[model samples]
Target: MADPNEPVHVTTTEARAGATPGVTRYVLGVSLVLVIAIFAFLILR
Candidate 1:
């Protein structure tokens, strides 16, 4: 018989992989916003 704990581990792994793209997008968007803000500040100053 299969162990119940194994399924939980597998599900967690799948969930993390599924969220990778979302995390990457969030990071990229924040980076772009920071870059633009910095550039605007420099230009205005």
Candidate 2:
């Protein structure tokens, strides 16, 4: 039998481990966009 009101504990390392790849990908995507925009501005100006 499971307790309906019981709180489950998640380890910080386990939680962050899953999210690390996603965060890395997001940062890379943003950085690439910023680089392209800066280059375009420099070429146009």
Candidate 3:
């Protein structure tokens, strides 16, 4: 058993391992734009 109140430390590299901020932002932006375009198209059709 481990201590319930023990503090755990984690480095930035370990915390963000396999994470890509730029690519994630790009994908999110593109998806948002596509969704808005689709809605606009439907509304204006």
Work out the TM-score per prediction: 0.53, 0.54, 0.69
1-45 per-residue lDDT for model 1 (tens digits)? 888777544677676775444688888999999999999999999
- The true-versus-predicted C-alpha distance at residue 15 of model 1, in Å, is 17
What is the alpha-carbon lDDT of model 1 when measured against the actual structure? 0.81
Better of 2 and 3 by TM-score: 3
Per lDDT, the best of the predicted structures is 3
Candidate 1: list runs displaced more than 4 Å.
1-21
Cα lDDT computed for each candidate against the true fold: 0.81, 0.87, 0.89
Worst 10 residues of 2 by lDDT: 13-22
**Compared with the true structure, what per-residue lDDT tens digits does model 3 show for residues 1-45?**
989899878988788886655788888999999999999999999
lDDT per residue, candidate 2, 17-44, as tens digits?
7555568888999999999999999999
Give the per-residue Cα lDDT of candidate 2 at 32.
100
Runs of candidate 3 with Cα error greater than 4 angstroms are: 1-4, 19-21
What would the TM-score be for candidate 2 when compared with the true structure?
0.54
- Model 1 TM: 0.53
Lowest lDDT 10-residue stretch of candidate 1: 13-22
